[model samples]
Target chain A: MSAQDEGRPIQSSTPDGAAAIGRHAIRTEALSKDFTLHLQGGLRIPVLRDVDLAVAPGECVALAGPSGAGKSTLMRCLYGNYGAGSGHVWVRHDGRDVDITNADAREVRAVRRDTLGYVSQFLRVIPRVPTQQIVAEPLMARGVPREDAMAHAAALLSRLNLPATLHGLPPATFSGGEQQRVNLARGFAPGYPVLLLDEPTASLDAANRDVVVALIAEAKRAGTAIIGIFHDTEVRDRVADRLYEVAPLQDAA
Target chain B: MSALLTAEGLHLHFGKVAALDDVALEIHPGEVVAIVGESGSGKTTLLRVLAGMMAPQAGQVLYAGEDVHAMGEAARRRLMRSDWGFVHQNPRDGLRLRVSAGGNVGERLMAAGARHYGDIRAEATEWLKRVEIDPARIDDMPLQFSGGMQQRLQIARTLVTRPKLVFMDEPTGGLDVSVQARLLDLIRALVAELGLAVLIVTHDIAAARLLAHRMLVMRRGQVVEQGLTDRVLDDPQHPYTQLLVSSVLAA
Candidate 1:
């Protein structure tokens, strides 16, 4: 289904300018993203076109689509990891609305620290850093006392079922499942107001997957706006309050 | 079905503060019940009382239809060792940090009368794997595991005996979102598969919703609402419950 097929974008007009993103925890208005194929004679391939989405506190919105449908691209665009082609992607950060597409680097970093948390499929480990310290770095950055932060990180690792013997070792040599757990621990450590989960449970087993689902439910109840891409239908059904279809560009055409 | 556990006219006091007042409840076989309330609501006191960890000034806690308090000290200890599991809020409270991870799991098997060392070790390894820990790390001490791992190890130790009933006090408290999430899932699955009765004390309504079949919403040491978990959470009739449900959403 195309964006047009999923009912009109529910954006209300504001007197100050375009629709206010402050009205929701996360909102994107007419977001258009295109990737340039410089290798193929600069082909301007459109990824997300005129996409509008709003996620409210205590709500979960699942993005559903096939591979190569730009769902991940859209998530990156909202996180400012990928620049948009046109339109606004606004996030409520520190009690104010900041357009991710236009926000400066500092503003974007602040939002990442205080307002948003993203959990991807892989862990980005700094070689030689202890697993406990890696998870603690973010909390330390936010001014948590060093001992308290490390304790919290250790607690998080335990929850992920990572054995205690590996606490002092780096995650670089860990298995895929272990690395994924580390990444999840970090993403969930911050308790950001909005969480973006991209198959957070992809490498997890039934036990771990259930944990991720419970975590998402708790976050929603705590008033965190969550946008996640869960390929597993059962997981999506359990956690998502609504579905937002991201039709491929070819389908839109 | 017969009651697996019961409490009658429970009362306790901490100096001038009445921690519990005329509290009463029961649990049936294979039933998962949750006690939820704000801090200082005496939910924890009720859990401790039922677990026979703390003596109540007035009232009786019955396990298998007998007064748990009236039982001989050795009998109570044996009952706790063989048929009951306790998962504390802090993993450290339940785990022996000095013991090797496998030893921690093996201890329970031994309590259940597993005589052979080789068999005890194998069973410990098996339980460790069941809780998603790598069995190869069986010799590692609980002191070395992360907080989440320690909690899982504690769970393994508690459930290794396949106890008929478990008492949990905020089983997922203080852990990160994802970790707590997984633990809740583990608890739910274990409770179902083992057909074990559980009485959990938690302030998290979401935890109650996911794991409990019935819920007791307490205020000032009294249950203001009690019913099927879905009924109470979805359409709470009590004013305090309404405020709690809405406040949790707004937070």
Candidate 2:
């Protein structure tokens, strides 16, 4: 699916001049990204091209595509994890649209703190940190009092069906499914304006998957604009409002 | 908000090394701004220059619209004892070891022209209680106190004058982890309660996150990144900031 296949016409206007981000929580304009694999004989891998994606408040837009179709690449670009080779990734922050592609470090940091959030597939476990603290850190970083943050963390953990006994222990030795729950709890507790979840329930059981679906529904109801990559079609159908297909590039070096 | 203290085009050099390189900052009234970086990043040097202790080869520090470096020695000393307070990393550097805790707190009051002995002693006793030290220990010398107690006492002495701006250099540097935690909590509470404008320098990212509303991440004597505290710690943009955040033992 090219940029036009999504029913949005190609925009030739300056990507930085103005943005329609007041209504939409996030949007990209003619955004293109490529990676130059230096070790592989300077091979240029074009992952995404002329991508125009947008999500409105209280909506959940899921990225749909086959494996290696650049879905995750697009997700990363939206979150400012990957630099856009050309065009702008405009994110609404502090009541203005900021292009993360050209934004300075400070601007990007400000956008991420209150406006955007991302939950990677795997938990980046810090050695010796309790599971509850791991989940509570994002809240604490946002200036929430420690006690309140911990209480909120504990509440989210329990909602995910994580046993109370395991809350005090680190997730380093936990099963993949358990760690995924921890990651989900951490990402969801802060209640960001926009969120990105990549394969959020890949390792979860059917029961836990249902809990995740409910969480997504609640977030959407609370006015959170979410962009997620859900390989599980059933889970995707339950939560997604629409699908944005990312087609693979034909010119691969 | 108007800034309480502003430094512009700060530059300093030690032999061949640039300890402070064209650094600039603004701290508003009742706001906490922290300078954070690894050792030898020039955060401490920047603090000293801002406090009027060390004159930068270039740049000017303005406090309430007056140039800090342009003031005479005597006027600067007078300013330091009254409107400004500095908390050194070592308590001994900030306190008089021979003086009793009460006397140390009272000395600043006396310097500020509170000559009545009764009022000075009463205020000192109140401050001891505020810092969580027993009021009865007011007569004890700083040497008799533990490390954490000494640090608390140092804080009490500095804050006794109700300085409009306070400069802290690693206030929890040498303490145990538990002690550091307590000190941080106390600092946070006191800073909020008094609405004191603070410029704290620390290598501890967690401490900075807990106390400062804004932070400057320095590297090689330059401000590589700076922004809201949560933003810098969460999604660090500069490569040096990312390395610094990753180096910490995450809690």
- The deviation in Å at residue A68 for candidate 2 is 8.9
Question: What lDDT does the true structure give each of the candidates?
Answer: 0.82, 0.85
DockQ of each: 0.01, 0.06
**Model 2, span B130-238: residue lDDT tens:** 9899998999999999999999999999999999999999999999987887788778768866779899999988889878877888877888777666556765556
Which digits, one per residue and each the tens of the lDDT, describe model 1 over residues A95-205? 667777656433465678788888877675434558988788778768788899999999888888887899899887998989988988898887888999988888889
Please, what are the lDDT tens digits per residue for candidate 1 over residues B118-178?
Answer: 9999899889888889999999999899888899999999999999999999988989877
Question: Which ranges of candidate 2 are over 4 A from the true structure?
Answer: A1-19, A30-51, A63-87, A93-95, A100-192, A197-209, A229-234, A244-253, B28-41, B73-84, B100-139, B156-165, B181-198, B204-220, B224-251
Candidate maximizing TM-score = 2
Off by over 4 Å in 1: A1-253
Error of 2 at A61 (Å): 2.2
What is the DockQ of the complex in model 2? Answer: 0.06
Provide the lowest-lDDT 10-residue window in model 1 chain A. A1-10
lDDT of 2 by residue, A1-253 (tens): 1211211121222244563556899999899987654344556778888999889988999998789989988888787766677888888887778777667544565577788989999786435568998898778767899999999999999999998999999898999999999999999999999999999999999999999999999999999999999999999999999999888788332
In TM-score terms, candidate 1 sits at 0.51
Which residue pairs in model 2 clash with each other?
none
